[model samples]
Target: MSISEQEVRHVAHLARLQLTEAQLRQMTGQLDTILSYVDKLSELDTEGVAPTTHALAASNAFREDRVAPSLPRQEALANAPQHNDESFIVPRVI
Candidate 1:
């Protein structure tokens, strides 16, 4: 899991960043350290453990979707600063 100067340079180029030589060296060392830590984590044993989306024992608690009545057009447009017959009028973006 070693990082090279050329790899750092390539990453920097892709990110549109200009790093000094010293910064590149520092980033290389930091990235290598991070990768080494991840490699160490990969050495842990997890024979029968099921893969989970979260670390805790919890599932999604989202409510079921139930379509109902919607707001009236007049009520929905009441708060608008400027609205036409059926749509809002905003300043031109370009």
Candidate 2:
């Protein structure tokens, strides 16, 4: 799909970005180049290729779920800028 200058400008306006005329021209060219490359990619022949979730072998590399020792509450709250009885205190929002 070819992206036109008008279309780019319309998209920029919708995104609430103010683009100069020169910036619009440059962006239009860049977008057109990207779309052309995507068009080239669509011409590849991959009739038997299987869709995959990952590029490498499908295997879990995560550690086993196990309970571990945790720091005490005083240690955890040691670095707090401000704290109440049991939690960090921040400026009131509302």
Candidate 3:
């Protein structure tokens, strides 16, 4: 598929871009080239090929989750600027 200068102008207008006459012509040619390459790729045969999100094989690198002991409430509140016996105090919001 080939791209026209009018189509390029419309796209530029939609994107809020102000293009010079030269720039519009350049973009039209560039878009035409890209569409042509896409059209060429559509002619390839891939009946048995599996679809993939990435070009190469990928695996998760996350570590296994485990139950762990949490910090004591007294220790956690030790560094607070304002706190009662249990929780930290903060300025009231509307």
Candidate 4:
């Protein structure tokens, strides 16, 4: 359950973090503590517990699908900041 300083540094690098030596040491300790807590959780007995998909009892309350009228093209584009004859204009991505 212990995390080494090297491992902490590796993780920080992967996460694009600029951790100092002192920060790395602190992160290593914190990661070790978190792993220890997880190890403790693994030791818990759950012999009779049923697996659950959600914390709350959830059911899908579905409604009927029906055809609905949509706004006309002109009305839909009325409030747009910028639009063309067919669609809204937006900044080019590439």
Q: What is the lDDT of residue 43 in candidate 1?
A: 97
Question: Model 2: per-residue lDDT, tens digit, 1-94?
Answer: 7899999999999999899999999999999999999999999997999988889897887999999998888887899999875988899998
lDDT measured at residue 33 in model 1 versus the true structure, 0 to 100? 97
Model 1 agreement with the true structure over 6-31: per-residue lDDT tens digits: 99999999999999999999999999
User: Which segments of model 3 are wrong by more than 4 Å?
Assistant: 61-94
Higher-scoring candidate on TM-score, 2 or 4 = 4
In angstroms, the error of model 4 at 35 is 1.2
Best by lDDT: 3
lDDT score for candidate 4 against the true structure: 0.91
What does candidate 4's lDDT look like per residue over 42-92, in tens digits?
Answer: 999999999999999999999889899988999999999999968999999
Each candidate: how many clashes?
0, 0, 0, 0
Candidate 2 accuracy as TM-score:
0.80
How accurate locally is residue 38 in candidate 2, as Cα lDDT from 0 to 100?
96
lDDT, candidate 3, at 36: 100
Highest TM-score, which number? 4
- Using all chains and alpha carbons, the TM-scores for the candidates as numbered come to 0.75, 0.80, 0.63, 0.82
Runs with alpha carbons beyond 4 Å of true place in candidate 1: 90-94
